[model samples]
Target: MSAYEFPALAIQDWLRVFCYDSYCADAMTSGLTNSKDTVLRWQLAVDTLYRLIASDLLHIPTLKADDLSAQKAAALDYIKSLAHHNPFSSDIEETSHWYLWDISATDRCHRLIEAYGIRDIPQGELSQGLVAALHNLFAENRVAWSDQPLIAVSADS
Candidate 1:
């Protein structure tokens, strides 16, 4: 499926899973808590990378070739548009705002953008709740990936 075809709920999962805390802090600081615009900006950042990775013709080894030039141009346009949101700008001062970069880098999920020097997202402050959520997501998902013995296993024990 194309990256644009990626489900909204899945995007939301990535947002919450990857960068919820920083977004919350920014929202609270800017007095835009629960703002739709803030959420949309975050989604745009996510979608740009998702699109690049999902592009059928844009493999990494041949990035210098002209095969996916049109697709690459479109993706770069998305990044440029995403930069207007302040948090996703390439400027060092705005690095903290690059939540998508932080999210993907922290999760070790995708680094193609960083590898290409497209953006730099410095680590941002994370709240205790966000830390806990990240831990839980990792722990639970890891258990689901294997048939290894699970400690404290019980539905309601």
Candidate 2:
């Protein structure tokens, strides 16, 4: 692990590596790649996040009341926006908005949506679904402050 690498990374990229490894033999990947600034890119690229979770390596942070309230407000507004507006047929368009269209139906995504009350980012790459996705995958400041103790573990986001 390079000194430049942090122990944490964005959840989407982390999950991407997990999926890549889950389906492909040898995951057909280095299982060790991440965005340049992203730590644990190299070693984690090969390992599935499911195993990491099972082994107690990855920890999802729980949001506080304030955070949850904000997320809920955002979500309600987003749902209102989505009313009668389908990505498939809606006039509004954004390319990155729908990457997880199929994956959104997964239990994991549903868990996030339920957990975070996520709606939309309202800023960079903000889409209601992506907001839900981020709720599931992304880490907050608490992730670093998590009570879980990690030692002798290879760094990955």
Candidate 3:
């Protein structure tokens, strides 16, 4: 495709396997207007992968390790914050709400790339595929970076 749009075959395959399968199921159940939770879950999976990459990019500590539960919590909180601030957060037709999270995710990836001046981002046959897919979707980094890192305390806590 475009120059920024990397042809990550592994990621494209993973998206078809993990995200779209559930997305299609949810869309069918609600006449193509599935619940926000359905879309949120998909976006969270994408965001979590990007956040993991960001952790590595910034040399941030990773207490969560491979467990992205904390990242999930932060993502939900970030979405909630978006819903509070953005009037179109509820507009699913515009691909707002959960889908709009890509703006933030992409911006994060672009920032990481600029910060490190990395030409080719690393990828694994297994894990990095998902991150690569996210990078593909949000190819253009439009959103501005924030000074404060996104973090949310789980409801369980």
Best by TM-score: 2
lDDT of 1 by residue, 4-77 (tens): 23233333233333332322212222221234464343544433343323332122232243556664454344
How many pairs collide in each candidate, listed in order? 0, 8, 0
Q: For model 2, what is the C-alpha lDDT against the true structure? A: 0.31
The TM-score of predicted model 3 comes to: 0.21
- Which 10 successive residues of model 2 have the least lDDT summed? 95-104
TM-scores for every candidate against the unseen true structure:
0.21, 0.26, 0.21
Ordered from best to worst TM-score, the candidate numbers read: 2, 3, 1
lDDT of candidate 3 over 79-146, digit per residue (tens): 44432332223455433433333322234444544443333434333335444544443444321122
Q: Model 1: residues >4 Å from true position, as ranges?
A: 1-9, 12-66, 85-157
Q: Which pairs of residues collide in model 1? A: none
